[model samples]
Target: MLKIGIIGYGTIGEDVVQAIGKDREGGIQVTSILVRDRSKYVVPSSLADLMTEQEAVFFANDFDIVVESAGHGAVKLYGEKVLAHGADLIVVSVGAFADEALQKRLMQKATERCRKIIIPSAAIGGLDRIAAGSLGPMEEVTLITRKPPKAWYGTLIEQQVSLTELTEPYCAFDGVARDSARLFPESVNVSAALSLAGIGFDRTKVKVFVDPHITSNTHEIEARGKFGQIMLQIQNTPSARNPKTGYIVAMSVMKTLRDRASHFVIGV
Candidate 1:
């Protein structure tokens, strides 16, 4: 089995564990779950035994990969440590890579250790195309993220705009992907992913909207390059436990894990 350690017990982490539990053929197992404080969370009965607060126990040599489903802070805390521990790292909070120094350090550690630092296509698709088109001259890439006003409740956008009182669509952020990722680490991860796959963070444009008219989180991607222009959009249902993120984000992580263990992989 592909033994994996997961950081965080929040929405994405729980969904990944539950999905892996239900998958009989995935050949994946959750060896450990690292949480900030075990006492703070009333973990489910099935996951109770796997939860641990000790960094040493969680970074034990038994795991083949460590998945970081926690926020950007957790990435900065455990990213290099996971690579140093000799396990491949899977990062769900891709926005953390916006920090150039941290990104370089973690990448260097993974390279020196000969381990992979994987980024799952969470909340969006067409990354493969972007990565491919990037080989040639690329003109531009832009990401427009529109989410329900409720999704912006605790985010920085609430300070810039009255999210609760927004009767129409309001553009809260319009800037480069780097600043967008750093500003809204929790919600603007897709912009970072797009920038990584297509262009550099400073070159990629990001626009965020808090729309009272939209019930679901929506993303629109536009890219132009030697491969030609392409436009893609997806409307994702928000996670029941966390409306700030999409439900498909967890499914994408699960798929990434399964692909690693499967003998026959359909999508790359």
Candidate 2:
């Protein structure tokens, strides 16, 4: 069996473990979890033997891979350590890569240690074509994200405008991916992923919208380059336990792990 370690015990992490446990293929299992408060959260019976981040690093040396579903802070805290231990790390919080210095450091460590870092297509699609076009003379890339008004409640948009009073769709912010990540850290993973796949953060345009009519979070990408013009959109349901995160984000993480363990892989 392929042993896996999870960096967070939040909704995405719990969902990944549950899906793996329910899969009858019997090839992958979550061996350990790296959580800040193991006692505060009730871990599933299957993963009762959870470990702290430090302990997880010790186990990562033996595990097949480590999945980081934790927030950006956790990624910055333990990413290099996991890679230096010779374990592949799948990071769901790709938005953290907007920090150029941290991204360079992580890449350097991974390269030096001959380890791999995986980024899943979270809540967005058509990344393969985008990445391919990046090899050519790409000119522009844009990301537009739409979510329910309540989704932007605690964000800077909430402080700027009343989400409850918005009767129509309102574009809250427009800037580059680096600025977008800083402005909307919890909601800009797709943008960050696209930025990393196609162009650097400064060149990727981002627009955030709050829609009163939309029930689910929506993401759209438009790109123009020498290769051609590509447009893609995805509407994702929010996780029942965590409204800020899309349900498809968790499913994407599972797909990434499955592909890693499977001999026959589909799509890059």
Among the numbered candidates, top TM-score falls to 1
**Which pairs clash inside model 1?**
none
lDDT of 1 by residue, 55-169 (tens): 9878764889999999999999999999888899999999999999999999899999999999889998899999999999999999999999888888888788877788989
Best by lDDT: 1
Query: Which residue pairs overlap in candidate 2's backbone?
Result: none
lDDT (10s digit) by residue, model 2, range 28-130: 8777788887776765565675556466454644777889888899789889988887788899998899899999999999999888999998888988999
lDDT of 2: 0.85
Q: Which residues of candidate 2, in runs, are more than 4 Å off?
A: 51-61
**Worst 10-residue stretch by lDDT in candidate 2?**
52-61
- Work out the TM-score per prediction: 0.98, 0.95
